[model samples]
Target: MDLDVAQVRAFVRTAEELHFGRAAATLGISQQALSKRIARLESLLRTPLFLRDGRGVSLTGAGQRFLRPARRTLEAADAAVASVTREERPLRVDVWGHLYAPTRTLAQVAGRAGTWVLGHGRDLPSVTDALLDGGVDVAFGRVHPPLRAGLTHRLVRLEPVDAVLGADHPLASEPSLRPDQLSSGVLWAPGPLDRLDFLHRFADRFGVRARTASVNLGLAHFLAGIAEDPRRFALLPADVPLPEVPGLRSVPLVDPTPLYAWSLLWRTGDGHPGLDRLTMACAAEARRSRWLEYDPARDWLPEPPPGSTAQVYPGSTPGGTRADAPAP
Candidate 1:
């Protein structure tokens, strides 16, 4: 009997994610639709591919054996399609974490990275789904782990972070402040602490208290909120251009400065030429601008996935390497 490519694709994604809700989201389909596809595939095979329980979904023995060939089948199909339509479309790239302004780094390499389309994603999960669904070719932002299988990422930059506070705040006059010093004030975030991974992690690590703003309008509005309360402070990358928000001051966070990590992510088997050009451009820019420099003794960074190491740019020494850094 012939197999349906869509049904096979659904199984592969669900097997990779092991969560119907997330797998469905990645496929841009409803959970019910995804379940129906998986059920049809299993029915055709006359065997159960997945073992479902209250805890979660997991691949059965048959599924474990089918996964490898399924992925190969999908890759082959993708390659066949790419051969005919690849050149007809420009590479599509997307970014998340707009509040942190991921474009600041993308703009540095866009000119030399070749023709492409840009899109915005709500966050990493949404972007990852788009990548898996072939909705986009590449993505940039902070990539936190447990990233699903069938994807790969490379650390591109580690931006120095600064503390933003009201000009009249007690520590605002200081040339540089330590992470611990910020414990005295509230850590203001653009959204909920659980949703703002970087800020939430920062607060937990540094013993600083974090509070989310009711609404996130934009940079100016967010910073203005901090300026209104002397006890309020926030963190931003050193290079983000601040709007004309009076009484707002950004001071370097020292005694272990926080470094925001940026990474480029894409499907593992994608062979798009634009992917190579973008990676090369990012590597060159990182080298020319020293974007990956890290001094563990003087800098603070979130821990990377176990066994994962930072991607070293050409001409850079191991001493300069950082752990797989995630984004702000």
Candidate 2:
């Protein structure tokens, strides 16, 4: 059990070369020194590993079995050394989320903490997958899947969403607008598939298939669509600030169907002072009231606006069978 590795190497080299001088040369030792090392190894092992003959040597059955295990022991020892070296490096925490929203908030939180980097995106699934795989530290998203390994989630915000339109548009003049009214006009609703269903149902309600003019995935494109074009409007989530587009206005989307409720997620068992503080700040922002509550619900209005294309109620959204509504 305590045989020296140097002794094992001496035994193997001599076995391969079958000559004292050649084995000594291979080991960078004199022949007498190598012979002495081999002798000590045989004694420790309590058996002659090689039988000396007139011109060469041969291994005992025990020597052959021992050769295989000795080679494996050397390999295992080398790997163990390499693995421990990697453990000495600093911990790398990878954070991920919406490029803009979390940037302002998560940074003010994570920066005060040490050792991490943030990756940004709107693709929730990819971000979540990265988090599960230990590739990302945390994600800000509208939807999160069921909990599994290495993940801990918290509801961050019940993200409010709004539908916007040009102030001069025919529909904007109504106390409440129906989706069918905009059927003939081209639609300029934004973002990807998750939110696109709202516009789809809006079109379906009218019985007229509406043409989507463009898919504006970025914030600037969504705002610019409203500011420049009198005919275009976009529905966006609440976290995004309404741009002060001079001729534009936004209305609460009576979604007919609600989509994502934005939230934040992280790995469990992590200890960081900075993130904990930031989480509290975000909670405060959530606690503060926002725009949608201020808009008068149609039900609460005492008198309906005259010449209205649709009946106005102050407290309620339009609620007939929206046959045109699309599944979220």
lDDT of 2 at 244: 53
Cα lDDT tens digits for candidate 2, 205-255 = 545454555455566656666656566656555455655556666666552
lDDT of every model, 2 decimals = 0.82, 0.52
Worst 10 residues of 2 by lDDT: 319-328
Which residue runs of candidate 2 sit more than 4 Å off their true CA positions? Answer: 1-117, 144-150, 174-187, 191-217, 226-231, 243-246, 253-260, 268-275, 288-328
- For each predicted model, how many residue pairs clash, with residues at least 3 apart or on different chains? 1, 16
lDDT of 1 by residue, 138-239 (tens): 899988778898787878888899998898899989999999999878888888888777888899999886465647888888888886778999899999
RMSD of 1: 7.7
Each model's RMSD to truth, in Å? 7.7, 19.0
Clashes of 2: 16
TM-score of each: 0.71, 0.44
